[model samples]
Structure formats: C-alpha cells, structure tokens
Target: MMRFVFSLMIAVALSPNAAIAQDKPSKAKSWNLTGQVKARFDAKVVDMLCEVSGGAACADKCGGGTQQLGVVRKSDGRLFPVSKNGQPIFSGAMADLLPYCNKDVEVDGLLAGEGDIKIYQVQLIREQGTKKWNKTSGFTKAWRKQFPDAGKKGPWFRNDPRIAKQLAADGWLGLGKEADVAYAKDEVE
Candidate 1:
C-alpha cells in the first residue's frame, strides 16, 4: 500500500506540467517581404486598438482601418492563398486575427509543437499619418451592468462583436456554445 501511494504521488506531481505543455499556445516569426510568399491569407489583429478603430465588422468604407493582411502576389500583383503546395489552412481565433486582413502583415508564429500559433508582429501597413494609440476605448469593456448576479457566474466578453463572429465561424452558434464547451467540460472533470 505504501509503494502504491508513492507512485500515485509522483504521478500527481508530474501531471499538471504535462497538461500545461499540451494547452500551451504556439507562436510565429516575422520577416520583411520584398519577394512574394506562396502562402498569404486574409487576416488581422484582434487587439483592442483594432476594435476601437475597426469596430466589429470589416470596417469597409467609413470605418477604414490600418490593419492589412499579407497577400501572396504575383509579379503582376495577382493574389492567392495557396502556397507552393495547396491552400493555406486559415487558423487562429478570428477575433484575434481577422481585423488586420487586407493589410500588409509580418507574422511571428509557430508551425508545429504543442502550443503552436501563427501570429503577426508588424501586422499593419498604414498609408500615411496615422496615430499609434486609440483614445476611444471601453466600448467592449466587460462590466456587470446587465447581469448583477450573486454568483461568480457573471458573464464575460459578451458585447464584443468580433468574438461573436469568431464563435459563429467556429461552429458555436449561440449562448449555449460557451456553456456547452467550457462549463460542461468543468462538470465532467
């Protein structure tokens, strides 16, 4: 019984680290593009500045933004998502990566390994005199104004439309998406 207890203790000690490593986020790398890259997709940065500048939608006319995506262009300047191989599998949270689409990008993310991500460093290529920081924020800022519940069961990240769009893209349709995935998992665990 003592030997079995010792083995169980060791397993418990090592398990957390293993679990952490698996859920770790991956990263990307940045490079200046003089020539054409084979794989370029429409993407953006989901940072707060972006939300203030671009809002929830694509920001087409009046909501013009600084964020742009890296496009794989030919000598004639025609663009494509397919690299030297096949089509690029667009990944990452859209709320986190889509606002910068159609703008020049410099990514610094990981290709493989446990916590891999393909993200942007110099994500935007603005045209001329644009201010660096956004003053008009706090729109999507989470507050307990709506749900004054006693439980820590208060909501989070609801007003932001980018996250909503991302959830929809990820096949999570409505309120039940967050409930079904996160809360349900905790119950099972």
Candidate 2:
C-alpha cells in the first residue's frame, strides 16, 4: 500500500496538467511562415499605451478601434502588439480585438516579427471560457458595412470605388497621365 501511494504521487507530480496548473506558458507549436509560428495562448487584450504605462484605465482608453490594441500573455505577461489580421492589403486586426479590450481571451494565430518588434496576427479568437471560436473577419465585415454597394466577387481593394476613383484621377502610377504614358513607353522599349 505504501509503495502504491508513493508511485501514484510521483505520477501525478510528473503529469502535464501539473505544469499547466503552475501557470507555465506554452510554446508555439509549428512554423507557418519564414518568420511566423503557430501559437494558441490565453491573453488579455489591452491598449498598448495603457498596458505599457501600467495604467489602470485600459478599458476606457482603448477608444473603440481608434487606439492601438494588443494582448498580454496571461502566463508570462509578455505584450504582443496585434498589427495585422488574416486579410489582404490595408486590413488590420484592430477591429477583431477591440471588442475584447481589457478582457481575457483565447487566441489562435501566427506570431511574427523578431527582436523587440513582435506582432500577433489573430486568426481566431474567443472570450476566455467560451467554447465557440470566432473567426477574425471583423475587417471584412466592417468594410462591407461601410461600403454596402461594393460588390463581393473580387478583392476588396479592386472592388472599392474610392480606390477606383483615385486611380482614375491619378492614373495607374499616381503621377498623372503623362508619367503613366512615359512608363508604358519605357516598358515597351
């Protein structure tokens, strides 16, 4: 009986859950891009300025997508500024993370950048303790809401009337028709 009890204790002590209970942060699992890695971790969304300054009014200062947002790893308190999302050009993760500002969430995405400049590209997120994962589609949703007349068949930039108007006014090279003609002539030569 004594030996059995000791063996059980040892087994429990060496278990993976024991390490989790101690609050050790999990490392990224696999490499996705040249400098990006797949990571899933619990973090608290925060306003970058407020979080770095140790300000207690982070929730109020987040500014509803106006101010920059980031996540602080719950296990290690490391702050990762979320700069992008799983979207094409001119898109950002701010809209996705803004609603959860100053709250805990589970994030699954790619971690990119190096040295002192780390960026978290949120691909999926859910409030802490929630079972349903929300896709990081806030940028597209917002764009559609703002530009209801924009067709949905192609890339957002190509479909955007504002960009189309600008391109038409400035020509393809944005340096007037003369420059565009000169560039085309040079290309043909």
Candidate 3:
C-alpha cells in the first residue's frame, strides 16, 4: 500500500494533464496565418484585449459591438482574430458577434494573409451548445437580399449619389486612396 501510494503521487506529479489543469490562462497570445487553409475549431468568443491582460472582470462588460472579438481556442487557449474579406474594422463581424460574446462557439473560415496579422474570414459561426449554424451574417444578409443590384458594382461603390456621398463621408469609400491590405496588416498587430 505504501509503494502504490508513492508511485501514484509520482505519476500525478509528472502527468501532462495535471500540469495543464493548473496552468494559468494564456497571456500574450496571438494568431498567425502563414498558409491558406480552412479550419473549424471550438472556441469562446472573447475580447482579445481583455483576455490577454487579465481583465476577466471586464470581459462581459465589453460587448462585441464595442470590442473586436476573437476566438479563444478551446484546445490550446490561443486567440485568432476574425474578420470578413480581410477587413475586420468595417466587415460587420464585430456587430454580428455581439450576441456571442463569452459563449462557446464553433467557427468555420479560411485563414488568409501571412505572418502574425492574418484574417480569419469567418464563413460560418455556431454556438457550441446549440444545434444550428449561422452561415450568413443577419445584417449583411438582409441588405444583400433587399438590394441585389445595389452592390453589384461593389458594396462601397453604389449607384445612388446620396449613398455615395454618405459612404465617402464615413470614409468607407477610401476616397482618393485605396485600402492597402498589406499596409493594414503591417500596421495592425
């Protein structure tokens, strides 16, 4: 009985599972997209800023609408930034994820771009405990269905002059400059 107990204690001390069970939450976590690949992973939607900085108390308070949401991988605790069309800022991803903050979710998407600043162009998202997948963003879906041709020329460049004026004013049109994806990637992260 003494030998058995000592062996069990040594086993527990060296077990990887035991180590992981006591591991602290990941800090300084970041995602990289060195290759184009499709992946689906279970994660919790978290505010990247708060999750890495020990801001647990503020996690729920920072709504998806206010903070850029990222997926904290259930397996490894790494965070991957989500976006649409390589544009996270204006892609409506943030607002679409407002309902999923702090929830366990399955994300399906193509990881695009190179280096640490990559975009996971989310093709689908589904709550893990739920049965259905949300393939289309509700906000963009309604707009696309309502005006099929309005965005045929590109969503930012509409035929309506008033809409054009508003887009320009809002800096969505990019004005006299192009939104350089490479530049943006280097600038962020």
- By lDDT, the best candidate is 2
Ranking by TM-score: 2, 3, 1
TM-score of 2: 0.69
Cα error, residue 118 of model 2, in Å, equals: 1.7
Residue 81, candidate 1: alpha-carbon lDDT: 20
How much is 28 displaced in model 1, in angstroms?
5.1
All models: lDDT?
A: 0.33, 0.76, 0.60
- Candidate ranking (lDDT, best to worst): 2, 3, 1
Q: Point out where model 2 deviates above 4 Å.
A: 1-32, 56-61, 88-90, 151-153, 161-177
Number of the top candidate by TM-score?
2
For all candidates, the clash counts are 19, 0, 0
- Writing each residue's lDDT as its tens digit, candidate 2 over 1-189 gives 999999999998775321231132433344465456566888898899888888865556498777789888887678888877766566889878888988999887777764334577777888999998887878888878889999888878889989989988999999999999999999999
Q: Which residue segments of model 1 deviate by more than 4 Å?
A: 1-91, 113-189
Clashing pairs in 3: none
Over the stretch 1-189, how does candidate 1's per-residue lDDT look in tens digits?
999999999998765221221112222222332321222222222333334444564444223323332232222232222111111222222322233444443332212213222222222222214434221122122223333442343234553345556877663535656665886688799
- Runs in model 3 with CA error above 4 Å? 1-34, 56-61, 85-90, 115-117, 141-189
> How many times do residue backbones clash in model 2?
0
